[model samples]
Target: MKIFLTGLGFVGSKLVTHLIQSPENQLRVVSRSPSATLPAGVHFEQVDSLEKVINWPTLIGDSQVVIHTAARVHVMNDSCDDPLEEYRKVNVRGTLALAEAAAAVGVKRFVFVSSIKVNGEETFPETPYKADDVPAPRDPYGISKLEAEQALQALSSSSGMEVVIVRPVLVYGPRVRANFYNMMNWLFKGVPLPLGAINNKRSLVSIYNLVDFIGVCAKHPRAANQTFLISDGQDLSTTELLQKMGRALGVSVRLLPVPVSMLKLTASIVGKSGISQRLCGFLQVDIEKNRRLLDWVPVCSVEEGLARTAQDFLTGRRA
Candidate 1:
């Protein structure tokens, strides 16, 4: 199989590594620069931007699958005047252009890596977001992704190209950045946090599991024209997660018993409401659809995944 992939960031780079392990598969990456640390045999194409019409027909020629992982990811303090329009330019318009080009070139499958935010920011305490749930994207990024999914589905119907959408919750692993990485750093340094009272349950995916599922979707017969919400299937509270991270780092977690209400109030006052919600909110996904339809299971347990992430952090390996 010939695979054309976009992006070389966290998930995409790992997926590229995994795909190249199979000698029968050939990999080509599209990026703005030719400086990616890809395997020797993998092909690389330099493209200015996904939003522009680049010779995609020739670029995607003979490719069986196009895995799209690039996007205008959500920005915490967006500087753009019209954030939604900015996101639409890349996430929606750019994605459709690539999909159309792939379809024109007879690509059989297009796997889109979407986010769980498409379902909503939060879930009910006991109820988890399902794959078929009505989309309620509250943020610009989520709305853009939802629109891209709709456009892709329509393109699939019209062009007879298989489209598979995989929505993954907070993916964490080696070389992770942003808030998760900061949390890991704080934990490693034995910084005391006041999240011991957060009792909300959240779902997260290990990069290993997400890449495995993407590979399955690339070739699985039942995965065609399907949407999947994937996770490790193990939900954890904030306190539990911190405890587990501490264990993985071989350190004793130092969490103060701060009241959840007080924490939220302080966060609101400090303009960190979003951070507070993520730390103390319920956001779990039901991944039964992927498990039942594709017979897919997470390759690593949560404990194992956490240990691996901590080890990578300690060793300074990108992994």
Candidate 2:
């Protein structure tokens, strides 16, 4: 099948590489600038104008599927006064424009890479997030992603496009950044972290697993107009993650047990209660839908993934 993908960033680059090597698929990538250095089989185009680039018949004329991966990711150090508006323009508006373009063309399938943040930050004991869960995005980025989901759903109904949304949590592997880099930096420095006492569970996904799921979504019959929350299916605590990462790095994890209350107080004083809550909270997701519908599970285990990630970090492979 011929597929067109937008955004050749980390996840997009990985997906494009896999698609290019696959004998069954032909891939094209669209970006704001024609600056992506992709593999031999992949094609690239610089699409500065969303409207002109996404005219349905033009964008999906020969393509059977279109995967929209381009978006303004959450910037932790952004200088924008209204980050939400900025996010809305790139995430929400760009998505809507692309969907309209896909609908105008004859594309049969449209896959959207959404975030699990659409369900909210933390999950409760009795109820983990499900596909049917009403979206309750708290932050600007999450809100923009959820808004894009809604807009895409509407387009699916009106445009007869098979829209599939995959919401993956904390995607990690080689060439990651932000919080994952922070964790790696701590490990590289061999710093004693105060996370032993925190037993909060979180769901994480390996990059390979996420890319595989997207491949399934592209053609699976049951994936039409469906939303899927994917993960590695292991809810590990902070300590467990640190320990595993340390093992992957050939080092012993050194965790100092500080009182949870004291840690919370310190975070509050620094106005980082959000960071504190995530560090000391439970956020588990149920991936039963992916298993039940598509019979999909992570092919790469956490141990394998972490080992690869550690090697990649040590080798200094940049995105």
Top candidate by lDDT = 1
Per residue, candidate 1 scores C-alpha lDDT tens digits across 1-319 of 8999998888988999999999989998887656466798888887788899568899887999999998888898798999999999999999999999999989999999999989999999999999999999999999999999999999999999999999999999988889888988899888999988888999999999999999999999999999999999999999999999999988888999999999999999999999899999999999999889999989989999999999989888344
Alpha-carbon runs more than 4 Å astray in model 2: 33-36, 49-59, 317-319
Q: Give the TM-score of candidate 2.
A: 0.94
Query: Lowest summed-lDDT stretch of 10 residues in model 2?
Result: 50-59
Q: After superposition, how far is residue 201 of candidate 1 from its true place, in Å?
A: 0.7
Over 4 Å off, model 1: 317-319
- TM-score to native of every candidate shown: 0.97, 0.94
lDDT for each candidate structure: 0.92, 0.85
